[model samples]
Target: MAQQNGMVEKRGAGHWLTHAGLILGVLFIFFPIWLAFVASTVTQPEIARPPMPLLPGGHLWQNYSKALTSGINAPVALMLFNSAVMAIGIAVGKIAISLLSAFAIVYFRFPGRHLFFWLIFLTLMLPVEVRIVPTYEVAANFGMLNSYGGLILPLVASATATFLFRQFFMTVPDELAEAARVDGAQPMRFFVDILLPMSRTNIAALFVILFIYGWNQYLWPLLITTDPSMNTIVMGIKQMFPSGDDLADWPVIMATSILAMIPPVLVVIGMQKLFIRGLVESEK
Candidate 1:
């Protein structure tokens, strides 16, 4: 009885320790956001003063309104719209291309199948930065610069999404395909009906991931979009800073930062169950 009680006490101690660690981690992660939120609510003068207050002030509406309507490079509203369009375009384009490519690799036994798969896989070895110069030149030559196509097309050529779908398709039961074949179903029909339904969870999860990836993109957007109207929120924030000899408006900047976090946070939160379900399904 005493031994059991000691074990129980030990478990209780460990549980509390785990909770304490989690709390510490949460605080650490949220501290910067909290500070930014606080700063967004305060006035510029208050922010310029050393050791800004921890609590929020009353300037929330004003700062956000100003940032939305009168951002330094362009209106934050316009930037937000551009970001949303780019993110959605990238996610959909990547998913569609990856799904088709993966399906071809898995379902159809074509000539040079292995060679083509290896070629696709080799793209993962190249970083975007390494290819950026040549990519930029290509975009310029193709008259894609300053266009939505330019913002998205170059970044869509990576193999990560293709690899993911290919691996998942491999794990699908071969018997399903056999059954479909016996039923006189065409390959495209089977893919559209059976495989697509099975992959819905994976698609959802990947959408969440790719959406955030596209939304947070900075370097590529910065390189491709010279027009103020085409700037994404991620890159536009830097443009908010004064070019020479003037101070940045901290309240507005912080407000924009907070605004920038909202969409991705909501996406992750809303799709968290689907994301977890997809992850588990994919692993199995």
Candidate 2:
């Protein structure tokens, strides 16, 4: 009895230590953003000046006004709209395509079906960076540049999500499918009635993941678009880092960065339940 109590005490101590480490790590990750938030309310010079201000300044409204309506070149409102249109469009396109692809792989077996599956799995090995040039040419060839379609086409499918659903589909009971077919139900009917309902947790989880991925897409967007008006908030932030000894307006830049971060943070927070449930369900 004493030995068991000692073991439990050891585990309790270990768990507390692990949790403490996690809390410290989270704080470290968020500190930079907190500093940026503080800096956003200061003069551009003061924002960039040495002996960095530990506390926020009084120029918040002043900076907010300018940052929101930056200038003739890069208005915050327009860039935010583009980011929204691109992010939502890509998320929807990606989810729809991934769902259909996953469904086809799970339900219908055609020639080279395994080959197609393996090819998608292979893409897991090669990230977007590897085939960037080819992807760029393909997009340019389609004349999709500077359009919402350009922003969305290349990212319309997600291998990770498809694989997630495929693995989940495998675990679904064959009995249910057989019963549905006996009841004169079609594949589409079974999918709509049984598969999709059970997969909601995983789907919601993937939605959050895909949304974040789309929201942070910068490289392809930058390469495909030369129009400043079409530039994402990230690209606008990049543009603020002027080359050749020019000083960056840190306050406005930091303010702009903070503004861009709000939506994704809200998304993750909003989807917390679905994310956790998906992770748990996938384990089963």
Candidate 3:
């Protein structure tokens, strides 16, 4: 009886400690968001003062309205539209190209297949920042600058997406292809009918990830788009500050930051099940 009681006491103490650690972690992650939300609702003068208020303020509508309508360089609404287009374009373009490439690599036995696969794999090691100069020059020569095409196309070729699809395709049963061939199905027909449906989970997961990635793209958009009207909300937030010694609009900037996070958050929440399933299945 004494030993059992001692064990119970120890377990209780450990459980409380675990809960305390988890609560601290949650607060650490969420506190910044809470602070930004609070700032967004308060006046600039309130935020400018030291030890800023932690609670919500009364200026929510006013601050958001100002940020949406009278931005420093371009309207926040225009930037939001540009971000939506770019994010969707990147996600869709990457998924389409990755799916096709993966299907070809797995289904077809072309010359230089291994070489091509290795080349695509190599891109995983190289980031966009490393190739930005040459890529920008190519865009400039092609006259793609300041256009949606310029914003979307260059970032669409994702090595990670291609790799994920390739791994997933390899796991698909060879018997499916054989059966399709027996039924007089062309290669494209088999892919369209069979493999595409099999990859739905992966597609959803990649969509959520790629959408967030493209939505948050700052460098490429900033580099390619000289036109204010074509600015993305992620980069446009930086433009909210004046060029020189003027004080930045803390309230509007905070409000814009909150708005910028909404689409990605909704995407993740909406696709949570598929995303989790894909992550688990794709690893196998």
Candidate 3 local lDDT, 1-284, one digit each (tens): 56767654556769789889999999999999999999999998998786889999999999999888877688788899999999999999999999999888888999999998999988877888999999999999999999999999999877788889888888888899999999999999999999999998789888877888899999999999999999999998888887899888999999999999899888778888866765565445
lDDT of each: 0.89, 0.80, 0.89
Instruction: Give per-residue lDDT, candidate 2, residue 19.
Output: 88
- Candidate 1, residues 105-213, lDDT tens digits: the string is 9999899999989998799789777888998999999998888999888777758788889999999999999999999999999999999999887888888888888
Clashing pairs in model 3?
none
Quote each prediction's TM-score: 0.91, 0.85, 0.91
Q: What is the alpha-carbon lDDT of model 1 when measured against the actual structure?
A: 0.89
Give each prediction's root-mean-square deviation over alpha carbons. Answer: 2.8, 3.5, 3.1
The regions of model 2 sitting more than 4 angstroms off are 1-27, 276-284
Off by over 4 Å in 3: 1-10, 276-284
Model 3 TM-score on a 0 to 1 scale: 0.91
Q: How accurate is candidate 2 locally (lDDT)?
A: 0.80
